[model samples]
Target: MNVAFTSRTLSLSRPQLFRGIRKVQSSFATCSVLSANRAVVYTSNGDPSQVLSALTFSNLPPPPPNTVNVRFLLSPINPADINVIEGVYPAKPNPNASLSSSGKGSQDEPVFVAGNEGLAEVTNVGDGVTHLQPNDWVIMTRQQAGTWSTGMNVKPQDILKVPRSLNDVEAATITVNPPTAYNMLHDFVQLNEGDWVIQNGANGAVGQVVIQIAAAKGLKTINLIRNRNDIASLTEYLSNLGATHVVTYDELSDKSFRQRVKEWTGGKNIRLGLNCVSGKPTTLMTRLLGQNAHLVSYGAMSKEPLSLPTSLFIFKNLTCHGFWQSRWYDSKSSGEREKLVETLVGLMRAGKLKEPSHEILTIQGSEGDEEASQKIRHAIATLAKGQHGKKILLKMEETF
Candidate 1:
């Protein structure tokens, strides 16, 4: 459904405020006349393929004070995004949004846009916004910002300006996986240069980032993945990413692998373990840790409960903690977030950080609403079936 835009006059006392208002008003007028926006939206929490639809709407009106209008360049479809859509995640979308397929909405019905992380360019800034201007690149710092749309109005505090040097893919994905990996490594334990780290699901996006960051820090990683047919090739691929050793869950199941791990680390204590795949495999990995080691879990890819032996905790002094990047963002200020982004960008510029392998699913403005909806639904269906090994990014055309 299309939204209608209306202009409002602002009462400004300062000269700078008047100038900002005029600039915003002019930009808003142009956008109201020329722009059409579309979003992947759903009314209720359920299977994305059944609930999600392509919603075409008028461009947003002029942003209110302390807000900025932004056009999203790219947004990634993270596994967490799917969980959020299914209503299984902790974060919820803002339901007060005025959106509908028929250009009308009742108080009882609320529309939810789907997406959390994205790269966007500021198109206009409202009065009282001085740090951002037109064409500045930014990434959402707010959880569940509904980034699937072509454009939206956001608070200045909810977004952080990123360096233009970062390519679209890197900027789009920088807000989530990389930060998760970076924080888990630094926040949990203080590892020496030759220390060892162990993790399951090591070929997944965050795992790969962990491997590279660990390697850069001169720490070793014992990477774990599920047994697959192309085991040798996968090992080689992860090894090149600086994984000291790549082991399958089958190998981890064997009792002798613990001794092998000891030999790999030269009998040194494995100080930190990262777990995304919980269950018996995680318990097996935990057994290999030395005294006072920490285990940080960020995800449960296997949807299994993390059950660990009590003996390990009591005898070995093993510490267990849960991590969520969204929580991390909530705990930090905008300046702190900016500093983290700067560190990641430096890593990217220095070749220490590389973009995750991804496929872009483009929704063209030229396509009819049904055609676009079908494309999104098909992609979500494929993801639901575990068909995609790489990340899937959504690139929405502006003129929808």
Candidate 2:
């Protein structure tokens, strides 16, 4: 609560906002001890859909130069994490390699941590590390290898200096959704101001951020939500976030709906489309695009294969693309990344960017410890539920 925001930029890839007043507080903490140590361990190499076990803390490796030992405050179990545990995703981290680098051998093959985003604090900083000190909070640069653990030794490169302005809960929600949204918008296609973008699964984590970021950049969004349960209210909520239109899967088929889309844009060709639900939604979205537009598919929520019409492909010359945010951010320069992080944190703190709505799974006392891990797995299995909000989160928070 004592953290302060300085009148400076903290920073991402979407449309780089210029001329806007932005500032960040140096949110760093130093020198704290963790007592009630524990971690959510994956018992078998299977569905994080069921549950994750609570385990005792063991030995951790010494921090090398520019590396630090972190005590995790919170972590989110994203849909991506579930896919990794279920052996469906390809971006699995080398938890074994992370351990081996820590001078620990893996005849046991170090327990694989399943998340791609987290907020942690340094209890100790190794030699030659001046930018970070004890207690300074940082988000994993690239999931930080094994973040589900209560403690970890990670390189500075994989940890971004979190704006001391934000909470672990807010920072925990970040790292993935914001960047994915930013990248998908800025990369693949060049969207001009006032251009319209359409996306299925527009109510999920990445999709929600896409709405906010597009709004911030003066772009219009036609968001597609599943037709179920209070979707009208959900539509209104996203409208508050600057979505130009909120339509259901059923609307995509109506020729009248396409006419309304043109009306909203005033016939401004839709330049880009984002697809997470494949099959029918994917095909319908292509039909609605203008010539040479790009469709970027990040996930297949409907679990259906994407199909493109041959006419739209050759005649319209539309481009199809894929976005893997983890891979792209991993390849960017640190300076470029620092800019992105600073921008995102500044927006979040200023309340310009809405934080991903999360259900906090506390890791404290007896009750929290008993159910925290299970709650994490459950959130992932049903991330798309809970109305229109993204499943932002806090995993464990036991204090000294």
Candidate 2 residue 106 Cα shift, in angstroms, is 7.0
- Cand. 2 Cα-lDDT: 0.73
- Tell me the TM-score of each prediction against the true structure: 0.89, 0.82
Candidate 2 on 1-400: residue-level lDDT in tens? 1233344433532243332222211111122223444566563567665645554443465677777889887787677776777767877666443333332223454656556688888888999888999989898877436677677788888788786679767787778889889889998888788788989898887888899889888899999888987888898988998888899988888878888888888988888999888998889888889989999988888889999989988888899998887777868888888888888887787776787776665655343444665666566556635332545454565433
Error of 1 at 54 (Å): 0.6
Output the TM-score of candidate 2. 0.82
RMSD vs true structure, all candidates: 9.3, 13.5
The alpha-carbon deviation from the true structure for residue 64 of candidate 2, after best TM-score superposition, in angstroms, is: 4.9
Flag regions of model 2 displaced more than 4 Å.
1-36, 49-51, 59-66, 96-109, 365-392, 398-400
CA displacement after TM-score superposition, residue 384 of candidate 2 (Å): 8.6
Which one is best on lDDT?
A: 1
lDDT of each: 0.88, 0.73
Best by TM-score: 1
- Model 2, C-alpha of 166: deviation from truth (Å): 2.2
Query: Model 2 residue 18 lDDT?
Result: 35
lDDT of 1 by residue, 183-281 (tens): 999998888798999999999999999999998899999999998888898899899989999999999999799889878988999989999999899
Where is model 2 poorest over a 10-residue stretch in terms of lDDT? 23-32
